[model samples]
Target: MSLLPLSLACWNYDRTEALANGSVRPEGIDLNFQALEVEETFFRMLRHHEFDAAELSMSSYCVTLARDNPPFVAIPVFPSRLFRHSCIFVSAQSGIERPEDLVGKRIGVPEYQMTAPVWIRGILQDEYGVDPASVTYFTGGEEQPGREEKLKLDLPEKFRLEPISPDKTLSRMLADGEIDALHTARTPSTFYSEPDAVRRLFPDFVPVEKDYYTRTGIFPIMHVVALRREVYEANRWIARSLFKAFCEAQRRLYDELLITASLKTMLPWQIAAVEETVALLGEDWWPYGFSRNRAAIDTFLRYHHEQGLSSRRLQPEELFAEETFESFLI
Candidate 1:
């Protein structure tokens, strides 16, 4: 039988390296895995549908689902997961010492609908009682010029979001106190270049993020692997095949990380770090599949709806292909 040719665009994550290097091939699929930067992959896939499959922003994917016919369908394979407490930056002049201080302040974000900001805003509201509607949001490029939301949003009147000037970037704006704070996925250049001007909201974020996980059990998901709807419609079996392959790849990564004889990564204490994470989050800390992530997915969906990103609340099951929800018993 001929293998179905499929092109996937994603970052070079250690977990997915097996797929990219051709060490693990998806069943009945000719995988053309393109290791591209996350931003580039998202731009090309969301704007032009350039690949058969791609790693997509979870928030953006949810935004697409609000449409009459979403262009893509997702498998449960998450390529990126992050704890975003460290992503929040505040201006020295902003007088924002705590999360509650962000109320009635101006926050710059690369995009209002980006996953990191969505999670940050939601976290602020749920954990800190800082209502998202109380603060105004300025959207623009982070370090470059002329950046805009990849998809059009029809956010309600309660959410005050405006675009910064085409030439202005969020990093500079935050340092100059043009915006009181910044919520972003990437650390801005100004954070290092203008240390006195820009500082992390949680200067010691490691403990804060770990505490958040202890309370909420949500190690936030940033990205998911998605297939073009046309491709999924014609070849439904690829969802399961690709999901199994990603699982296999992740298992290999775990094995590599456990090899204490020689460190699989550059970190001299890589095993110690892994041990610490397992102690905190259990053996399968970074889990895939619908059932394992239902709480986190449900929380994010609620945030999506509350923040006016999704027109209606979406269920956890609605986000993934049905085939990925379960596996056949051996």
Candidate 2:
């Protein structure tokens, strides 16, 4: 069988392991898969025409692409409900006993524009009446925020923002008390952390409720796999096949016995985290297909716009390929 030319890019998370291992049938040329440190950098590679396909954070990718209107188009693999358990975790030692205690605190986030923490912080500030400026938001490393000027997102005042050179080391610092909190948008904590080393302050932070998850759908907080418009138009069959393969992979992975076994073999706490995520997401949060929920996607767009993260008001439909999505659904 002739292999298709597909280059898959993803964030540095463990869930992608299933995708990397051909959990679904491998399609496209394995130009070799690359996992990136942040969604912003991953999108940079996409814009530079480095790869054929990639999984990106839907909200972050949409906003970034909408800035100059990149030639690529996103096809969401799963609804946002699948991302419910992704959270803002605080260290138990930090004495951040409650979300209300986060005021004027130094928060350590994985990336400059990760979606979960942005919303969590906004909820704290806007809904809880905390001062945004008092909160110190630090990007892990030295890489500066690229979309800041283009998107015009307002960062917190006097923030200790710096991108981490090695993202793994940033996680270490978080464990060692170098940072107060880590913003996570993945179900499994092992992708960027060790739950054993750090006690979770928000063990019950289920940002998306079940009804909202099933209805308006969960926003893509973590990864969104996208294809360039021209490429997608030419190789529509490949797109369809890849989506099927990915969904199949997710389905197999989410199988309770298999998932529990996989976790059991890894670590006790890892298993716990997976179970926690499963409990939070219920049974529906598995990758199925690239069906973009316009309303939920718009929530992200409006949020980024309100945060001054993006200058342009991105319409969700512009970022996704509706025709292809419809084909998948049908």
lDDT value, residue 292 of candidate 2: 37
Instruction: Report the poorest 10 consecutive residues by lDDT, candidate 2.
Output: 142-151
**TM-score (C-alpha) between model 1 and the true structure:** 0.98
Q: Residues 251-286, candidate 1, lDDT per residue (tens digit)?
A: 999889999888889998899999999999998889
**lDDT for each of the candidates?**
0.94, 0.57
Tell me how candidate 2 scores on lDDT.
0.57
lDDT of 2 by residue, 1-330 (tens): 677667766664444456666554655534356666655555465447567777655555655574454667776564233333336666545677766787767676655566665565554564457554566665543122222211224453444465444443444555666666666554324324566656555564454344345554454454567776677788676666666666655666556434554562456676566666577655654544434355556676776666556667777666666644765457
